[model samples]
Target: MSYTPVYFSLREFVDPAIFAARGNNCWQLLSPEILRAADWLRGIFGPITVNNSYNGGRYSESGLRRWESTVGAKYSQHKFGRALDLKFRAPVTPQQVYAHILANQADARAHGITTVEDINSTPTWLHIDCRNWADQDVPVMVKVVQP
Candidate 1:
């Protein structure tokens, strides 16, 4: 009953180091909730690019980041495989995706997305995470984080 992303591969969800080290086994390290959320967002939007290094693209740390990586915060969700920085294809912008999630909070929550980085902070990509926001008593369905 485990849900795997229909629109993404293991490479897209992991960095080059993890993908090379764990190979297909990398799926075991990822959070199912975050994977489900990714699939849901991909279904609603068009194509989403996470880590494209497998295809000779520049993105690598957009998905899962290793502990040694200094990309974002030291305790970033990326290190725990609970977050993703999605770069949408043309005709689909980050602002549109953010707006969609904000408007459809219940639906987004149903798909396991609890937080999203502010659009202003990430103008090129949409950062979504399955953080445990219920413990914080945040009234919002989807919490918009500044970072």
Candidate 2:
């Protein structure tokens, strides 16, 4: 097994809304694979808009409830430091981002990574995750989700 170093962050918060909503600022950990995946995604997108990444463990209960009503569970990969949700510029669908990720999946897999659709099956964002295990490519959906 590849040794994935544990990364501890001193940042006050990971997700803004979660922080504003929950009134807490703390993080658990993130693996190296997840960091590599995040770096690869940022490089591919080239300063694209981002929705969420590395969430802090501080959110108002009500805010978390509201978030869950839409996105489900305040605790997620974003909080765990192994995932990223990206937003595209105008006229670009989430499916397009997913397709882009899939197109580059070959290279991504080489670094032990994978991507998935946005929550609620909407094509507004794409979620990418990385793990220390450099295994085979995990099957992912590359279809466009229309609103």
Candidate 3:
């Protein structure tokens, strides 16, 4: 029932319909890296509402497409359970959070943070992921301002 330890619960990550279709076996099947990313994001930004009314974090397969169709890159880390878009409560900006992670990237690495993004469309939430990456040889940092 939480986003850590068992980070990908059906009630949280999977949409109700998706969860019903696939059943519970896959509900808690998120990657450890994804869990670590959630942990890292929590450490940097306190009290994030991942599955609240805001819909700030994890998305089911259908959920991802429903909200992010315009963004393209359908097969994003999110679909593969390697990414999350998180929003902090207050007193935290995307720039500040990004810099915080960048400043302490070595620490952030353990939490599987290979990529950090600030989509200008919604600067409050930071999109973080590692996709198929298995090492930290080169991390990708991008800032996209959707017009």
Candidate 4:
């Protein structure tokens, strides 16, 4: 089945990367499952702007390194292809967004997400991934290293 590319509002931060990945000015390239999770979040939050999605190959190396140092993983869901970093529109702090994610954490997990982070100890953004696995009721990595 052919999949249609859709833009999730939360993928805005990952620009240049996401756009360059596609020939056209695409926002994100998500699988059906990932799209569904995006849609789910949309329904819960009225409307959200995408922060980043599908980093362009050009930025892959640098982006990967940054994510590894920040998120710490050679193969992040975002790198392997099944995750997104989300944040609210202006006037919305990361903490507020984190609250939203935490509020709906249960429902989000049901859609096959296995990881959700408030983006380091700073709580700058929300990182969510769809691993095609059942909701395990706990984050894959919960070691919060506060700075």
Error of 4 at 39 (Å): 2.3
Worst ten-residue run, lDDT, model 1?
131-140
How far is 78's C-alpha from truth in model 3 (Å)?
1.2
Worst 10 residues of 2 by lDDT: 57-66
TM-score per candidate, in order?
A: 0.94, 0.50, 0.67, 0.53
Q: lDDT, candidate 1, residue 118?
A: 93
Candidate 4 shows a clash count of: 15
Leading candidate by TM-score: 1
Q: lDDT of each structure? A: 0.90, 0.46, 0.55, 0.48
Full-model lDDT, candidate 3: 0.55
Candidate 1: global Cα-lDDT? 0.90
- Top lDDT: which candidate number? 1
Give candidate 3's TM-score.
0.67
Each candidate: RMSD to true structure? 1.6, 7.6, 5.2, 6.5
What tens-digit string does per-residue lDDT give for candidate 4 at 1-147? 323334443234334444455534332344445556666665655555454234332222212123334444556656554665545556766567556656666565555455565455546556666554444445532222222
Question: How much is the lDDT of residue 41 in candidate 2?
Answer: 54
The model with the greater TM-score, 1 or 4, is: 1
RMSD, candidate 4, Å: 6.5
The predicted structure with the larger lDDT, 2 or 3, is 3
TM-score for model 2?
0.50
lDDT of 2: 0.46
